[model samples]
Each structure stands twice: as structure tokens, then as C-alpha cells.
Target: MIELSRRALVAGAAGATVTGLLATTMTSPAAAQDAATPAGPAASPIPGAYRYKVGEARVTAISDGVRTFPMPQGFVRNASGEAVNDALAAAFLPPDQISIPFTVLLIETGRRRLLVDTGNGPGQGPVGLLAPTLAAIGVAPESIDQVVISHFHGDHINGLLTAEGTPAFPNARVFVPEAEWSFWMDDGEASRAPDRLKGNFQNVRRVFKPLDGKVERYAWNKEIAPGLVSVGTPGHTPGHTSFELGSGADALFIQSDITNIPALFVANPSWQVMLDMDGVKAAEVRRRTYDRLVADRMNVAGYHFPFPGAAHLAREGEGYRYVPVMWNPVP
Candidate 1:
């Protein structure tokens, strides 16, 4: 098993709490004012990428950026607006608004490198950070050997193509779920899609049409790449999938949109998100997935989780609690 540690870093001085340190340091009014003012214009925050190990393989969590907005009407189909706000408040998040993050996973075995999912393409507001973050970690797009898609969601597929409508990972082979391809590629299904989903049908074509004959469709329970087995985790989409990433004895579950935002959906598994194609079925799968995670004590890496989104789950009452894994500076 991989050695997991939990060590909290102190903000300022030893034995001093952040609040206490601030109180002592800002005693003078001028000191406080001076503290707030920078000597010169500050630079923009540098985006980050995190890497750790899963057995012998190195796994990096590359951020794609985030989307923050006020909670829209019907964001949670089954829950009342008030209930949704309550959940957010319980999680210590700001009420009335939510920030959904997008993260893509890179798994590197000594022999090959694989990307789990792509992020929202470039130029998307507050997103499209995947490319830069990858570069930040010294990974070039061309070095990726395989691109494994979790589902057909725009956020997960958009990064597959570049601004020029060319394959982003020019040298990589693309693998998609067989079920997902059949559902989205069928004209009959596209024609019957409701207005809200009509755009999704068109968008699917827009992303995949350029990769025709270059794409390889995969099935459930199969190893799409070495040590990476595709697991059928439908409901978010008819062909939505997850993966069991095992290297040696260490394993991590790459949960792709199993729960959109952990605070809202993971804590309240029964509450359905607007993106779920089949809310009821999505709920069922979410519950089942969480139950397994809890029982097996498996660590998970979520696509929409906070930056470097990797954690462990514990059963809390009728739902599950998210416990983030400790960051190891050297892996």
C-alpha cells in the first residue's frame, strides 16, 4: 500500500494560530495599512499542478480551472433552493453561489503516459487551464500516449481538439466508451433530444467529427490501458464511465462526474444535479459507488473536485464525508 500521511502546516510561527499571529503582527494601525499595501504591483497567482504516486506509477492532477456563479434555478432538480443553500452552508462554502472545478488526471507508468479526461477547451471563461498546467509540470501534449475519455460531457471532451480543430494530443491514440459513442452518434437519438440537450448532441459531433477513424471505442470491464480498467458508471450520461487505476498493490478510483461538486452531491447523494441525464439512476450509482468506496477504504480522484482533487471517503450517517489525502511534497 502507498504510504499516506496527514500533516498540517502552521501558517506563521510555531505554536501560533493564524488568527493569533495576525493579531500580534498587526498591532499598529500603520503596520496594518502597510501590510495591506504591496511595494509594487503584485503578479497574478501562478496556476499549479500536483503529482503523487500510485504504487510505481506517477499520477499528476493538472487543473483545468473553475466556474463560479450564483446557483441557478433548477440547479438541483430534486432539492429545493433552500435545501441546496443549506448544504452549501454546511460545507462552509458561500451561500447562493457555487464554484465548480475541473481537473484532469495524468497517469504515468515507466513505459507509457495516459490522460484520463480533457478539460473545457481554451477561451472558456475561468477554465481552459489544463494546457498551461500541463506545461508547468514539464509535460508536453505530444508526450501523452493515450487519451481516455470518461464521458461525452463538453467539459471532458472539449480539450480533445485544439483551437484549429486539430487533435490536441497529436501523437496520442484516443479511447472513448463504446456506449457513449453509440448514444451520441445516433441521429435518431439526436433528433429526439429535448431543446436543453439538443446543443449537447451537436457539440458531440463538433468534437468527434474531426477525429473520425482515429478514435478507438472501448467497453466496460476492459483494460483500456495498462493497469487502467474502464468501469461502467452510467447515469450522468448513458455511457459515462470511471476507472480502477491499479499499479502494483496501490489503487485509485478516477471518478469522472460521479458527483458534480462533492459538497452538494457527495454529502447528499440523493440530491440530483441538473447535469445528470437520468437523475434517479445517477443517484443510485452515486450511492452504490460511495458505499463501495467507504467499505473498501479506496482513495478517489474526482474531475470536478477542488484543485489536485484526490481524497478518501468515510461513511457519515446516511451519506459520505470527503477526507482529502495528505500532500506529499516528494513522491
Candidate 2:
């Protein structure tokens, strides 16, 4: 039995509280001048947090930021670099460069604050903003009730611990797919893994070792909270999962890293990206998932999609197209 920790990092958790000087010095003459200073030369604020509703549940897309790298050969293992470049150009993206963004979901079910995935935790460059974004949205890191991980990938599970290697969400129960845990936690499995995969195996052990007796392993077809249902959409990882949010008569599918940058994979379903652990299985799942999304005309969310990564999938010609949901002022 997992003896989960009940400890919490409690402070200013009753309601969203601004921690900086602005709240206290708003009336000060100095504050007025500071506000007029324009902070610095014109620059756009970092965009991350967003909110919407799935029935009575309040859902948010908290961004962890992005990693932009020069397009490497075999970025799409099955497709040629030239073909990928063409697709990028068609999507109006710069050629020879790829940017992967990370967006985690927050589902507030009136009673429970459930986070779908934790982004790259602190120390990761250009990422690790999940904690701050939660703060901005009035949710203290300690206030999260439970964290349901899609799989054990670094970007998804690294945020589970702090810089010192302790559970970041002290009081929250960490739920992971049982299948993922079994494979990665096995000593024999890691020993036989290829050199390139040794790091991934090591990282998973590093993250969950301390919480061995505490992590809750869940199975597929289970309701994570209330209307949030876990769907087994593996392949990227042996146990990678996606979710379906059903409320009232409405529904939203949470597609977790099933496909990265839809402009590439979603538009060309047959073209496989580099990270599809089981490329064939990944492509199979991708096609099946998108088919349902198109038939249902469902609103969906993707972790690697642009910030607030909520969109609708459509069957274009050979592959499919993603239409982003228009931003709404109210949740």
C-alpha cells in the first residue's frame, strides 16, 4: 500500500494572493512612477495560463514554455527533412527550425484541483513555468489536490519533484498509469535498455524512487476525478494516456502528447515524428484518435500545441487540420 504524504506547503492558500510589492504600494507616489515607466522597451508578456469550463469543472492550460531547435535530420523519422521543411513552410513556420511547446491541464472540479501533467520542473531552460503559472491563476502549488501523469517522460514528470528532489506537490496524490510504472521501475528492463534510452530509464527511477511507497498507480477506464476519464492512448510511451472530459451533454478530449505540433503530424498522419517510441503504434493511435475527433467534431487539447492548446480537429484531405478555439473572456 502506498503511504502517501499528507504534508502541504500551505501559505496564502485560501484565495489567490499577490505576493509582490504592488498590492501594498499601489497608492504610493513611487508606484505611480514605476507603473508609468513601461517596465522596459516594448515587449510582449510571456503567454501561458488559460481557463475554460468542461461542464461544471473549470479547466486551465498552464504552459511550461517551449524548446526551439534547428530542424535536425530525421526529426520526422519516416519523412525526409525536405518534406518536413515543406510542411513547415505550408504552416507559415520558419524553415529548418522546430519549436515544441508544453502545456499542462488543470481541472478544478469544485472540490478537487486536478492537474493532468506537470511540466519540466525548475532548472530546465525556457521551460519550468508551471509553478508560476499556477500561482498567477490563484492556485498555489501546494493547493493542487492530485496530479495525474500521462506517462513518465521527463517533460511530463520532472515537475513532480522540486530542485532538492522531493515531491513538489507535498499533499497531492500522484496518479500514474500502472503499466508505465511497471515497465520503467523494473531493474531488468533498465539494464537491457539501449544506450540512448538509458537516460530516460534513469530519469524515471530518479523521479519516483523517493515516492515509491506513495505513488498511486491507476488503470485505464477510471474516472480521475469526476467527469475526467482516463483513456489508454499509448505508443509514445508504453503507457502514455489521453483523457476525455464529459460534463452535462458536453465533452472535451485531452490529447496528451499523442501528436506534437499538429501542423506536422496532424496534417500528415502517416508521417511519423522522432519521439514516437513505437513509431508504428504511435501512428496507428494518432490516426484512430484523430478520426474520432473529426467524426465527433470534438474540441480537444494537446500538450504540445501552442499555449492554451485547445482546438478542434478536422479531416482536410489526406491527413487532418486543427482549428484552434477562439479565446473567451469568461471560463
**Highest lDDT against the true fold, candidate:** 1
What tens digits encode model 1's per-residue C-alpha lDDT throughout 186-241?
Answer: 99999999999999999999999888877999999999998899999999999999
lDDT of 2 by residue, 1-331 (tens): 0011111111122233434322111121111112324233212133545556667777767678778899878889988888898999999999999999898888878778888989898777677877755654457777888999999899999999988998888879899998888889889989998897899999998998877666898899899778888899988989999999887767889999889988899999887777878988999999999999899887889999976688888889999988887654421
Q: Return the TM-score for candidate 1, rounded to 2 decimals.
A: 0.87
How much lDDT does each candidate structure score? Answer: 0.79, 0.77
Superposed model 2: Cα runs more than 4 Å off: 1-46
